[model samples]
Target: PCPQHRERALARQARLTKPPGSLGRLEGVAVELAALQASDRPDLDAVAITVFAADHGVCAEGVSAFPQAVTGQMIANFVTGGAAISVLARHLDARLEVVNLGTVAPPPVSDGVVDETIAPGTDNLAVRPAMSPEQLDAALAAGDRAAARAAEAGARLFVGGEMGIGNTTSASAVACALLGKPARSLTGPGTGLDRYGVGRKVAVIERALRRHADPRDPLQALASVGGFEIAALAGAFIGAAARGLVVLVDGFIVTVAALAAVRLRPELRPWLVFSHQSAEPGHVRLLQTLEAEPLLCLDLRLGEGSGAALAVPLLRQACALHNEMATFEDAGVQDRS
Candidate 1:
């Protein structure tokens, strides 16, 4: 974040033809984005959205309501512009990239998807480590490459999405480990699981937590309980921040990824703009932990960066108001005498 740009934006906001703080959070949003983009007037015209798709081995634990094959199927849906994020991306005219980290059942035609599969999928995290050190590194690298692509495409904002069956369970486990909270506290009915299924998911996460002792290490926790898409989202966020792009974090799974990335590099926190509060039980806690105030909260649990995509308009509007709105002097308005 640039202090100079922030100061300039603040000064300009004070001169706008409105009462001080009249625009509420939008005023702050514009200033913060100005700081993040190192510009007195920042815009989200070039937004890059990358949806990382993978299969989670924990699906074997019967965690999700959907089949593991849905992960791959959704990847196809993303390219075909059938998914929610796909439609949002087109609506916003943002650049959307889909990455295939790994899946047991892959799409028949992956023409638009970036292939970065570390394996068929991670090992069942309940019984074994989800990813080896090498695989984790590969996933992080894949995310970094995606970020590089976004930067090359002149993206000012980066939105990361994930598609992986059983990923909510994996994300819950990772969040539990990172936050030192109980699995039951973070676990939720992913993909519309019933109460019993939620309880079962909690039990599975508890087992994985017990197996992976010393959850203090972020990298270790991710390797033990994280999904490929989760790790990749973390990496892409860090990568995006390094290149001076504002990151709009998505739902629960993506929030966990943001947590992991912030733990790895605390400096990256300022660059992150949480998009919304997810319907997932753990998401509120995660937001509390991060001290994040999202732009919206419409009970969104579907990932694929849909929430972030939705928030883009807010950021754009904020910038528009900041840059185009008349100042007191320009509008010939009376000052508060």
Candidate 2:
């Protein structure tokens, strides 16, 4: 965190017309940006949003409401600019890069799709490691390379999104491994799973967690119980911090990835800004684990960086208030403090 920029922002905020701390989280958002950018004021002109699409073998275990084929279909939908995130990206005028990490049915080469297929899909974590070590390394590299490209394009903020069927199941299992919790506690109804389906998902997660009992090893936990997209999201967060880019994390699944990344590099915590609280049952626990105070609480469950993209305007408003609001002297008003 930029200590000097934080102090300067606080001092400047005191001189503004509003009462101290009136802006609530908005004020905090401004301070966080100032610290990240190492400036008294911050802006988000060049932002990059990357949506990583993949499939989870756990879908074979009847964990997800949607079939695995939807993974590749959604990637095609994204490329054609029809998905929710696609519209949001265009509305924000942000660069949207869709990566085909490893879908069950890989899309043909086309616009807006980056080919980084590591495998057709991960092995079912219920019975084996989701990915081999080599595949894990390759997924991380894909995410790292994606973030580097964003940085090279002059993106000051990187909003990492993901699309994968049965990913919530995988993320819950990873959380169970990392946090030493029961699968039942972390499992939720993903993609319209009913209570019975949720119970089945829990059982599958329990199986994966039982296989990999070492919570001390984050990478092992991820490889044992994570999906390709989740691993890439973790890698992207690390890479963004490496490039000094401010990261705005999305919903439950993305936050799960960030948690793993934070466990890997605790120093990356300050560079992260959680966008919103997802309605997914386990998201609250993940956010609490990160000690993150999200900027919005719309109960968003959409995972395609929609929550994060929606909050960008709020960040812009925070910056506008911090940078454009006049001081007491400018307005010829008496200082309250």
Say which candidate scores most in TM-score.
1
C-alpha local distance difference test of each model: 0.94, 0.90
- Tens digit per residue, CA lDDT, model 2, 169-189: 998988888898999888888
As a TM-score, model 2 comes out at 0.98
Q: Which ten-residue region of model 1 has the weakest summed lDDT?
A: 211-220
Model 1 clash pairs are none
Q: Which digits, one per residue and each the tens of the lDDT, describe model 1 over residues 244-292?
A: 8899999999999999999999999999998899889889999999999
The 10 consecutive residues of candidate 2 with the worst lDDT sum are: 103-112
TM-score to true structure, per model:
0.99, 0.98
What local lDDT does model 1 show for residue 323?
96
**Cα RMSD to native, each candidate?**
0.7, 1.1
Separately for all candidates shown, the number of backbone clashes (residues 3 or more apart, or on different chains) is: 0, 0
Candidate 2: RMSD to truth: 1.1
Best by lDDT: 1
